[model samples]
Target: MLKKLSGLSGIAIIAILSLQTNAFAQNIVIPVETQHNALVLQTNKSNNLNIVYVGPTLTDKKEYEEVAAQYRQTDEYTGVSNAAYATTGSRSLFEPALTVTHADGNNSLDLQYVRHEAKKIDDNVSLLTVDLKDPIYNFEVRLFYKTYFKEDVTEQWSEIKHAEKGSVVLQKFASAGLYLKADNFWLRQYHGDWAKEMQPEESKLTHGIKTLDSKLGTRADLFQPPVFMVSLNKPATEDEGTVLYGSLEWSGNFRIDLELDNQDNLRVIAGINNHASPYTLQPGEVFTTPAFLSVLSFHGKGEASRKLQSWARNYKLLDGKGSRLTLLNNWEATYFDFNETKLKALLKDTKALGVDLFLLDDGWFANKYPRNNDGAGLGDWQENKAKLPNGIASLVSEAQANDVKFGIWVEPEMVNPKSELYEKHPDWVVKQPNRQEYYFRNQLVLDLSNPQVQEFVYNTVDNLFTKNPRLAYIKWDCNAVIYNAYSSHLKNQSHFYIQYVQGLYSVLQKLRKKYPTVPMMLCSGGGGRVDYAALQYFTEFWPSDNTDPLERIFMQWEYSYFYPAVSSSNHVTDWGKQPIKYRTDVAMMGKLGFDIVVSKLDAKDLQFCQEAIKTYNNIKPIIWQGNQYRLQDPAGNAVAAVLYLNEEKTSGVIFNYLVNNRYAAGSERPIRLKGLDPQKRYQLKELNLYPGTISSINSNKTYTGEFLMTVGYNPDVKAGRASVVLALNVIMENS
Candidate 1:
C-alpha cells in the first residue's frame, strides 16, 4: 500500500526514489529562470509536476527544493495537487489545461512526470522542455518554456502527440497554464468595439472564474485582445507592486480563463478558444499550440510594459530595429473617388509636406464590377481601367516622379458576391451547404483553408510586387470576419477555424520570404487582427479608424501597455472638431501620417502641418526607439502626458494633452518626468507650438535633470483641447 507523503521526510523519500527511476523522477525540480524572475516546477510523490514558486529569481538548487517541500502538504478534503499542466480526469478539480477523449472513448487523462531537458540557446536565451505522458495510454505532452534573460520574459507552449492505433479527439488544449498564490488577485483586461479599441478596465478576482474571450473567428481583437495583467496583493499601478502580464501570440478565436480555486490559488489558462474547434489527432500525429508570452515583474506594470516592448523590438517584430516611414493614406481623403490626376495631386502635396510615402487605399481594382462601393469588387484584383486609364503603374511612376515611395491596399482575404472572381468561384467563400451566408461590410471571408484560395491570396501580393518592383509598401487589409465558418476544403468541419488561421500564417510566411525588405501594414477593419503572430509579418498596424484626437489619446495610451509606438500607425484625419495642431500632436506620438486632404487645409493649418511633420521627422528616432513612461493616465486625469526617453537617457520628448476642461483641477500640477539622468543638466524646447499660444515652459532656460524630475515642469495647457510637445537634450558644459 502507498502511504500519503508529507513534510521533509516525504521530500527525502521522494528524492531517494528519484535516484532509482531515471524516466519517472518523483522529486526532480526544474527551474525556468530569466534575469529577474523565476518559475520553479517540481514533481511530487504522485508523479505529478506542480508549480512550486513563481517570483524573484532563486539562485541555488536548494531554494527550489525548499519551496517544493513547503508545498507538499495535501488538502484535507480533495487531496488535489496544483499540477503545472493540469489535465482532465486526473486529481484536478479546477479548470484543466487540457481535455481530450481517448481512442477507447474515455475522457480521462492522467499525466505523470517523464523527463525534462534544458538548453542554452544563446547568451541571452534558454529553452526548457518538460515531458509528460498518460500512465494508461500512449498519449504524450511536451511543454516548452523559452526564456529571454535580458527581457525578463518567458514564452510557453505545448505539443501533443499520440502513438495509439486509433484516433484521439482533442476537446480542449491550452497554450499555457500559470498557477499563482496570493492574498488577493487584481486583473486588468482590455475591452472595446470597432472605433474604441484597447480600453483598459480593472477588477478584483473573487470566488469564481472570470473569462475574457473573443469568438469572432477572424477579428479576434474586435472585442478583447488576448492579453491581461494580474497584480498580487493590491490593485496594479504604473510603478508600485508585483505584476504578471502576458499576451497570446495568436490571431484567431482566443480565451483567457482566470480561475480562483476553492483553495485560494489562482490559475490562469490561455489559448485558442475551442468553441467550434475540436481537432482530431490521427495515428503518429502531433499538434502544437500557439505561444503565450509572459513576464513577472516586481517593479510593477510600468517595468512589465518596458520589458515586453524590449523583447518585441529585439526579437519578435518584423524589421524590429527599423523605423517606419510617414505616409499619407488616401482612404479618408479621396475615399475611392480619385483618378490618376487626383492621386498625383495628393502625391505632390505629400512630397511638399515632407511625408515619405503615399498609400492608395481601396477602389483601385475591378473592371467589370467596378469597386465604387464596399458592395462590389472585393475579390477582383485587376486594375480598374475606368478609374485610371493608365493603370496602377502610372500612379507608381507619378509617385516616383514626386520623389515619394508608393503603396497600395488590398483586401485579399475577402470577397463580394458582385465581383467577377466571386461569380466565377462562389465555392471559395466560407459557408455552410444549406445555410445562408452572412455578410460583413457587404463582404464574405475567403475560405483560406482551401489550398487554391491560399494560392490566389499569395499571388495577389506576389503579382503586384513582381509587376511593380518599386512598390515600397503593401497595406494588407481584411475587412470582414468569419461568419458561416464552414469550409468545404476541411475534412472535418471542426477543423475549419484552426486550419484557416494556419493557412493565413502560411501565406504570410511565404510573402515575407519573397518580399523580405518590403514593409506591410496589417489592418483588419481597424485594430481587428493586431496580434504578435500577425505582427511577425507586418511592420505596423492601424490602431483604429476613429482618428478623433480625443478618442486616440485614450486608445493609444492603452495600446502602449503592450505594443511599442513604432508598431502603431496613427494618422491625423478630418474626423473631429479638434484643431489640426492638436490632431497632429496625437498622431505624432506613433508613426506619424496624414489621412486628410492636404489641399483642403487652410494656409495656416497647412503650414502648421508642414512644420509638425518636419518636427516629427527630426525627432522620429527618439519617439520610435525609446522607453515610454505614462506620466499621467488618461483614464481619470484631465491632463494626459507621455514621455519617451532614449536608451541612453540623454535625449527625450514629452507629449502633454489637456483631455478636457477640468476648471483648473489639474492645471497647477507640474508633470514629473521619469527615466532621466538625475545628475545631468538638460535643455528643453517647445516644438510645433500653436502660432498665437504662448509657450508654457521657459524655453530659453537650462534646468538640471534632478530639478526637472523632482520639481517637474508645467506646460500650462489651456482648457479647450490644448496640447504641447517638448524636446529635451542634455546640456554639455564644454559647449
Candidate 2:
C-alpha cells in the first residue's frame, strides 16, 4: 500500500508482490532517510527484516542492488542474523531477537512475518511498522523505526501484543539489533562514579561476547553512561574514520551487548535490561520497550558527535536559543544560615558582578518541619517564614530591580524522616512493609509509582507555582538513590523497579505541561542521572558537585560529546579550592555561572570577577551556539584544550588549560584549531587579563585559519595550574 520497496530483482519483485496481496505472506520494506544518508531495510518471505544499507543514499535500483550484493558477501544469512519483529528458533545459533514462553509450557518461539504499513509523519520524519506473528502462541510484535530528516539517526522500539487465547512470558526482547561487517573494530563505552562521570574507555572487539550492562535498578553513572560507539581499527579522530554510535533513551536499568561471531559478524543489541526476571503478559495485554537510537558516520568521531548534537538541539533541549543567564547561586556563600540581611548583602554583590540571575539554594522552605540541613525538611514545600519573615517576594523584587531573575532549589522526589510530610504519610516512602528502610543523606525516596502520590506531588508543586506568579526557575534536585525499593500498590514487587521511573516521568510531564516556559535544571546529587531521557524534560544538567577545575576538565569533555555547551550548568566557585582565574576559565566553556561567597572576595578578586563576566559575555554567542572541537584529549594529560566555532565558522573561542604539571618546558605542544574556514583571515586576542592570570602566548596577533590549523600555535610555557582563553574573529574573506 506504500511506495514500492524501491529496488529488487525479477524473482525478488515477484516474491514481494505475491506477499503484499496475501494475508499469510505479507511483508514490508522500510526506508529511513537523513540529510546526508539513507538506511534502507527489506523484509524477506519470513517477515524477517535486514539492514540493507546504512551508508550513502540509494537513489536508484542499481545502487541498491550493489549495496545488497556487497552486504550478502559479508553476512551470509537468510535472515539478518537478528532480524526485527521476527523470532528465530533455538537451533538458529545466534541470540534470539525476541524470546517468548508459550502457555503450552514450552519457551521456544518462532515468529512469521504477516503485514506492515508505512506512514510519512512529516517532511523530515517517517515511521515504519512491521508486524510479525508467533504462530504457535498467536502473539504479535510490532517493530517501529522513526527516522529524522535532518539528523543521521534512527530511533528503534517495539511493542509486544498477545492474543486472548493464551498467556505468554517474554523472556528476552531487544528494542533494536543490528549485524554489521566487522574488521578489527574498536568498541568504546563510558564508565565512572558520582563526581567522576563519563570516563571514556575503549577496547578491540574479539570473537566472543562483550557486554556493558547495569542491573542496579537505576541508571547510575557508576554502572554505565547509556551510550556506546564503535570505530574502525585505532581510535578515530574528530574528522577521519568511520564510526557507528548508539544511545539508549531510557533512564532506568539498561543493557548493551556486542556479540562478535567467528565469521567476523558483529551483532549489537540494546534495550532495557531484563535482570533475569521475565515479564509475564496476560491475554490482550501489551508491553513496550524504550527507544534505542542508532547513527552511522563516515567522517569520524567528531562528525558523529556533531550529528548527535544536531539531534539534541532540534528535539531534546528546550526552545531557548540564546545564551543562558549568568547566575550567582547563594549556596557556598551562606548554606543553612538563612537570614534576610546577609542574603540582601549578597544580592547587592551579585548585582555588582553583572550576574544575570540569583539562585537562593536550599533552606528557603519547610519551617514547620525544621529543615536546616540534609537532616530535615525535604518533602514539605511550604515556605520558611522564620528564615524570611517577608517571604520570597522581597528577594524576587530586589533581583528584578537589579535586572536579575530569582530561582530556588527543591528536591521533590525525596523526603526526610524528620519532616511533617513523611510523618503524615508514612507509607508514601519507598520500602518493603515490615522491613527496615535504608536512608541516604537522612532521606528516603518517595514512592512515585502510587497514583495518589503522583497526584499529591503534582498538586503541591502546581500550588507553589499558582502562588508565586513571578517564580522564573526551579533547580530540581534528587539527593539519593532508591533503596529498600518496594511499592505497596503493585502486587508484583518487580514492577516497582520499572514503574518508578515511569511515574517520575509522568510527574515531570504534567509539570512541563502546566509551566511550559519556566526552565528547570536536572541534578541527582550531581551527575547521577545524566542521560538523554532526563535531558528531554530539563533545560540543563549539573554534571557534578565537584567544582575542581582539573577534574571537571575530564568530566566536561566527556559530557560535551553528546550534549551541547548550553546544556551544561558549569560554575566558577571556591577560589580556595582552586585558582580563581583558572576556575573561571574552565567554567567559560559551558553555560557560565558563579557559586561563591561574594562578600569574602577582596577588591582584586572582585575586579577579576567583573572582568571575567565581561569577557565571557563578549564571546557567549559562540560558546552557546557552536560546534566544539577537542584539540587535546584529557586522559591524564598535563595540557588539554577545547574550542568552539560559530555556525558560520567566522568567529570562535578557545580554552586551553594547564593541569597540575609544573614542568612547562616539555608540555608546550603546538595546538591545532578546527571547524574554521580555511580561506578566512582571523584576529586572535588573549583573554586572561585578571590580576593573578598570565598568558603563555608571546603575542596577540592575526593569522589565516589554514596557518592556525595546520602550522599550529604554541602556548607560553612556565605554569603551575594555569589556563589561556583566546577569542578569534574573522578579519577578511578569501578573494
Candidate 3:
C-alpha cells in the first residue's frame, strides 16, 4: 500500500520510511517531512480505502514558515486530582511522541497517533494515551474545531494533522473533541472565505470570490456548513478506562479571534461524553482526530471567574418591602448626559409612579456627558464626579432616603483607549504591540489574563459592593466584540482565546463570591452573552438594548428556546414610533421592567405599562418555574406560544400568539399540552384581558393517550395584532 501510494505522487516528500510488525500481522509507519502538503494513503490498493489530508494543519501554519514548539520540561501542576479527568497517573508520563501501528488481520484498518505528550508536575510523570483517532472515516476529510472549554484546556485536546497548500496555510483547531458533523470539503469550499483563493475552492460560477475590493467578513463567516468532524466520545464514567487522543500536523495561518463565546463550555467538561469515537483502532495509518480545547490557554493570567451557577442556583430574588423598583433609566430620561439634577427630577416623578429601583445606564462616568464615543469613558469604572455630583454613593444615599434601591450598569469586559485605566496601563490592552490596534465600538479588550488586571477589577467591584452592600442589583454589561487576535499576557497570538475567556470567568467568579445575594443582570450589549451558561449565575438576561416592541415580539419569541421568559428583561419600546418593530407584550413576558422615563409616559402607555406589569405578576410564577415547550418558532412562523404549569398539576397557563398575516383568514392550529394528568378533565379559562377571545374549543376532556387539542384560530389583522390567550386548569374533585 505504501509503495503504490508513494509511486503515484512524484513529490512524495514524506513516506513511511519503515514498517514494523510485532504481535500481529500489523504494519506501523511514521512519516517524516518538513511540512505536510498533502496526505494520501491507499488502505488496500484495491480501492478499498484511501486517507487524505486536504485541510489545514496544527499551527494553522502557512507554507515556508517554521511551526516550532518551545518544548518545556514535562511537569505536573501539583497533585493527581489536578490532572482534570484527562490525565491517568504520573508514573507513565513520557516525552511528546506519536505511535502508528496496524493490527495485521484480514479485516484490519490502520491506526495513527500524532504528537503524544504527557507528564506530571512536582516529580510525577503521568502515563497518557493520545486520544486522537478517527476510528470511522466513511465521510470526507475535513477538520472543524471551536474553542469551547471554560477554564482548563490542553493542547492534546485539539491536536490534529496540520494541512498546507502552496504558500497559503490552514490549521486544525479541534481543541474541542468532535462535532456532530457530516459534510464534505467540496461543500465547505463553496462557502469558505479561507479556501476561495485557490481552485474556486471547489468550483462555483466562472468568477470566483473577487478580492479586488477585498474585505474580510464578520465572525459568523467562520461558521459555514460542510464542516468535517471526527465523531469522538468516551466511556460514560471514570472507571471506564478512557484515553485521550493526540495528533500533529502543519499548515496555513490567518488571524482570527474565537471571541468570548460560552456555547461550547458544556461540551469540554473533561469528562465522558456519549459520542465517543465509534471504530476500532488500527496501526500505522494516519488518522485525524479533530477537537476543541483550551489549547492556547494562558497560565500567567492569574485572573479567574466564579459563576453564580452551582453556588446560587437555588437563590430566589426577594421583593422589596417598602416599594418595587420605580426605576429611572438614564436612557429613556436622557440617553447620554443626564446630571444629578436631571436624575433627581426623574426619580421624584418615578417615585410617585411606585418605581423603587433607581438604576443608571451608560454615559454617567465619561466626560463626554452621553457616550459621545465608546473609547473615551469606559476604561474608567469610576464616577464622572463632573456629572454625577457627590459620586454614586451620594445618589445611593439619595435613593435610599426616597426608599428606592440603587443599581448601576458596568461593562467590565471593555476598556476605552481614551479612559484613565487604558492610559495608565496601556500594556493592559490586547494588541499586536506595533500592529494597527483593531477597535470595535471604540473599545479595546483588557488582558485579564494578568493577575494585576484581575486585582484591579476586583478592587473596583469590591470597593463599590463593600462600601454599599445595599446595592441590590447590578447590570454587568459587555459592549464590544473583540478583534486584533493578540494578547500581551499570552506568549503569542494563539493564546488570546483561552486567556480572554479565563479573564471573563475570573471577574465574574470574584463578583459572585463577594455579592452572592445580589441579582446580577447579564447584558452583552443585550443577548450577546445571554445563554444558559451566563444564566447559571446571572439572575436576569437583558434581551437587548433596542426596545422596539415590534422587534421584541419576534426577538423575545426566538429568545425562548434556551432561556426562560422571566429571565428575559425586555422593556416596552415606542409602539408609536416603531410599531412594526416594537412589541410590548412579548417583551413583557420576560422579567417585566420599564425602560422609558416615567415622566414621559402618556396616559395610554402608562396604563399599558400598569396592565402589562399586572399580567406579568399573575403569570410570573408559571413562567419562572414552569416546564416550557416551544409550540411555534417565532423566527420561522408568524408568532410563537408557551405553556406554563405550577408544580401541583392543578393549574396551568397557555399563552399563544396568532402572530401572522391572519388574512389567509383564521385556521385552528393543534397544540399538544405536556405534563397533564391522564385521568382528570380540566376547565379552561380564557383571559378576557387579552384583546381576542376563544369562543369555544376542546374543553374538559380526559387525556388518555398522547391526546390532541386544537385551538380555535382567528384571522389576520395587521402584522402584530393577532393574539390567542387561554388558561387551562385541572378541575379538583370537590370543586
Against the true structure, whose lDDT is highest? 1
Candidate 3, position 157, lDDT: 31
Error of 1 at 707 (Å): 2.0
Q: How far off is model 2, as Cα RMSD? A: 5.3
Best by TM-score: 1
Order of candidate numbers by TM-score, starting with the best: 1, 2, 3
Worst 10 residues of 3 by lDDT: 297-306
The worst-scoring run of ten residues by lDDT in candidate 2 lies at 1-10
Candidate 3 runs further than 4 Å off: 1-328, 348-356, 367-375, 531-533, 575-582, 635-639, 661-675, 686-721
Every candidate's CA RMSD? 4.2, 5.3, 16.0
- Models 1 onward score TM values of 0.95, 0.91, 0.57
Which ranges of candidate 1 are over 4 A from the true structure?
1-26, 71-80, 664-666, 692-694
Q: Taking the tens digit of each residue's C-alpha lDDT, what string does model 3 give over 38-76?
A: 111212221112122222233442331221122132343
Query: Which pairs in model 1 have colliding backbones?
Result: none
Q: After aligning candidate 2 to the native by TM-score, how far in Å is the CA of 412 from where it should be?
A: 0.6
Model 2 C-alpha lDDT per residue in residues 1-735, reported as the tens digit of each score: 224544334544554455444534433445666776776666655545666656667666346545555544445454546454435554356665577777766766655566667788888778877776554445678888888777787898988887634777777777887767646678889887777778788888888888787765544455477888888655676788878888888877777878787667677888777664477788888888888887788888888877787777777777436447788998988888878777777788789888888888888888777678888998888878888887788888777777778887888888998899888998888877888878877988888888888888787768767876777878888777777777777777757767777888899899989887677787877777777777888888898887788888988988887788888999888833667878888998888889988778888888988988988888887887788888877675667878889889888888888765654532466788887788888887788567865555544477888999998776552365367788778886453
lDDT of each: 0.86, 0.76, 0.43
Residue pairs with backbone overlap in model 2 = 696-716
